[model samples]
Target: MAATTALDTLIDLTKEALDQAARLLAGERRTQQQVLQQLQTLNQYRLEYGQRLQEALQQGIDPASLLNYRAFLGSLDNAIERASQTLRQQQQKVDNSQRLWQEQHRKLNSYDTLVERRQQTVMLHASRAEQRASDELSARMSRNGAALLPPSDQSA
Candidate 1:
């Protein structure tokens, strides 16, 4: 019984840990998604700017204006690269969190199994003991009943 109580406590703690891990994983995933969205937006903006530059070149734009457009595109490219890197790092964090959650879940399952086995053992012992007591009572009743009966006569 003490063991069962201890296991129950451990199971509760493991469940809490598992829940916390799940929350962390969820947060990490959300951050990763946000990073991905930002990266996509950056890519789209860069594409649009590049198209504008192309149009300007086709329409005979001034050299200074062309340089400015090219410089801006370069900066946009850099930003996109950084965003991509951040997304990768965030994905790693999400993966780590998922693993942590899995481990905690496994621990909880182990504790539950232990508790179940302990209960089964206790129940089996109780059942055996009851059976023994019932058998003893039945044997005692039979012996007492035989002694109470009168002896049969030999001659008819």
Candidate 2:
């Protein structure tokens, strides 16, 4: 029982650690999602801007305006690239956190299993002891009852 208490405390600590890992994973995933959303918005804006640029060129746009559009689009591309890299890093962090949480959960489950087995063993021993005592009492009662019975009356 003392050992069980110790294991129980360990399990609780492990569970807490697991929970923290899960929360961190969630936060990482959220950050990754936000980055992806930003990437998507950038792409959409780039596409729309490109379409506008084509329309403007068809209407005889100035050289300076076209150069500016190209430079800005290039900058948008760079931003998208950086955001994608950040998203990938965040995803890796999320994966690592998930693995950590899984390990902690497994450890806690193992402790719980040990405690259950220990309790079962204790119960089995108690049951056997009770059975043995009951059997002894029954045997003694039988012997006493036999001794109190009347003796045989027939002569040899």
Candidate 3:
């Protein structure tokens, strides 16, 4: 019984740890999702700007004057595009981390369940053994009753 109680306590502790992990993962997932969305929007803007610059270049617009026209703007756009790619890579890493955390949580829960089952089994065996011992004692007493009976049969 004591062992069973101890196991239950350990199981509770394990569950608490699992819950905390879940909350942490949720917060991280939210942050990563926001970053991912921003990256997507930036990538789309980069594509649109590239097309606009290409159209201007085809019209015999002096590419040198285009520095004031769109060259500086193009540089800024390319920088943002590179930043978006970096963010995407970081978000992918975060996603992988979240998956690993979830898998670890599941494995811990499974182990906790196994511990509970074994504890219960141990308690059951202890109870059964106690009952069997009691039964054997009762049977022994019944068999010895005749020897302890009164001496009435000797007088008759």
Candidate whose lDDT is highest:
1
Candidate 1, position 77, lDDT: 97
Write down the TM-score for model 1: 0.91
Clashing pairs in 1: none
Of candidates 2 and 1, the better by lDDT: 1
Error (Å) of candidate 2 at residue 89 is 0.6
Q: Residue by residue across 1-156, what tens digits does model 3's lDDT show?
A: 787687677667767776777777777777777777766777677677667777888876675866755765666577677777767777776777677678767867787778878979889999999999999998889878867987677656
TM-score of each: 0.91, 0.92, 0.61
Q: Order the numbered candidates by TM-score, best leading.
A: 2, 1, 3
| Model 1 lDDT, residue 100, Cα | 100
Best by TM-score: 2
lDDT by candidate, in order shown: 0.94, 0.90, 0.75
RMSD (Å) per prediction: 1.5, 1.6, 5.3
Query: How far out, in Å, is residue 73 in model 1?
Result: 1.3
Model 3 pairs whose backbones collide: none
Instruction: List, residue by residue over 1-156, the lDDT tens digit for candidate 2.
Output: 688778888988998998898898888888888988998999898898889889999998899999999999899889989988988888898899889888988988898888889989999999999999999999999999999999988897
Sort order, lDDT high to low: 1, 2, 3
Instruction: Please say which candidate is ahead in lDDT: 2 or 3.
Output: 2
User: Which runs in model 1 stand beyond 4 Å of their true positions?
Assistant: 154-156
Cα displacement (Å) at residue 119, model 2: 1.4
RMSD, candidate 2, Å: 1.6
